[model samples]
Target: MYELKEREMIFVFTGPHGAGRKTVAEMSGSTLGIKQVISCTTRPQRPTEVDGQDYHFITAEQFNEAQAKDEFIEVTRVNDYLYGIKNSDIEKIFKSSGSIYLILNRFGAETLQALYGDHVVRIFIYADRDTLEQRMRESGDSEELIATYLSHYEDEMAYREQCEHVFENVDLAHTVFDLTKTLDQYLNRNLLELD
Candidate 1:
């Protein structure tokens, strides 16, 4: 007889690039002691990124092989590099009795929601187009890259209704405060409140 393991809820932060989703996800994960699910990518790791912490960097051949095995829940190509989330990663989180958090795009968020059903909490982070563009510039992105990134804002904003919550990343402290509260309520977790 197969005994089912208890499932831990997954919190997903998603939005257009330069929306500050990653910042919110990382902070919330750290505060709650939830692990941020590292994505796998075929792109070369940047000097600032550590393997397994930033991403599971792999060869293009390895990525294709995993794809052939239907191992990825979602995959996307960005700037000629492939990035994906493995189904096994989610299973690992469930097995460890810990929740998972991820910063993904809309497609990835939808895929996770489909796989996890109600266990998945989709948060669509956003800011005004001007604010996002300014943030991208402040982050040291080239003008061309900033333009390319914000071009998809409208399309991404269209997916906002698909998410469980919409968060505006205006003030960092306030944004994280709301995010923690929302996540705690959704997961029925008391990790945030010290009482």
Candidate 2:
């Protein structure tokens, strides 16, 4: 049987862009009462996102200043935009919850694991190339950027084995179900009262 230690855990979901990492993380966080780490980003916020909720949208200068202060636990540059998770945010969650969900890039996920050791549960998510492209397009990404992401997909997927669990996100609802079930088994909880 699969096992995760009994304690509040840091759940980090990561994968190539358009693989539904954020979608699944949001669903799981809502259902399981897990706090999510809202990352700070230099990218423009989408219309559907609210400031401080989906992300803490910031200027590049602000991001740079924070980075210089050693405030972020991990930082990555994607398509020229900077994305990072604040160290204080993770520390607060660790002190206050049964679990916390982090939607991260592969680099951020790796950094979390290295920093937190056994308290971190890494879940790698992915989908077929066509599905990835479709999701990216649906999100209004430009063709040039989509191509760039596609080109990096293989390299991103190569980190799969380094993760503690891996899921292929083919269908959002079904995938969410499976992920929550896996989390229930992993953390030993009826996280959503599904029983």
Show where candidate 1 strays beyond 4 Å. Answer: 1-7, 191-195
User: Quick one: best lDDT, which candidate?
Assistant: 2
lDDT string, candidate 2, 103-173, tens digits: 88888888878877888889999998999999889988889989999999998899999998899999889
Q: Each model's TM-score, in the order given?
A: 0.88, 0.88
lDDT of 1 by residue, 155-195 (tens): 99999999999999999889998888888876666663554
lDDT of 2: 0.85
Q: What is the TM-score of candidate 2?
A: 0.88
Candidates' RMSD to native: 2.8, 4.1
lDDT of 1: 0.84
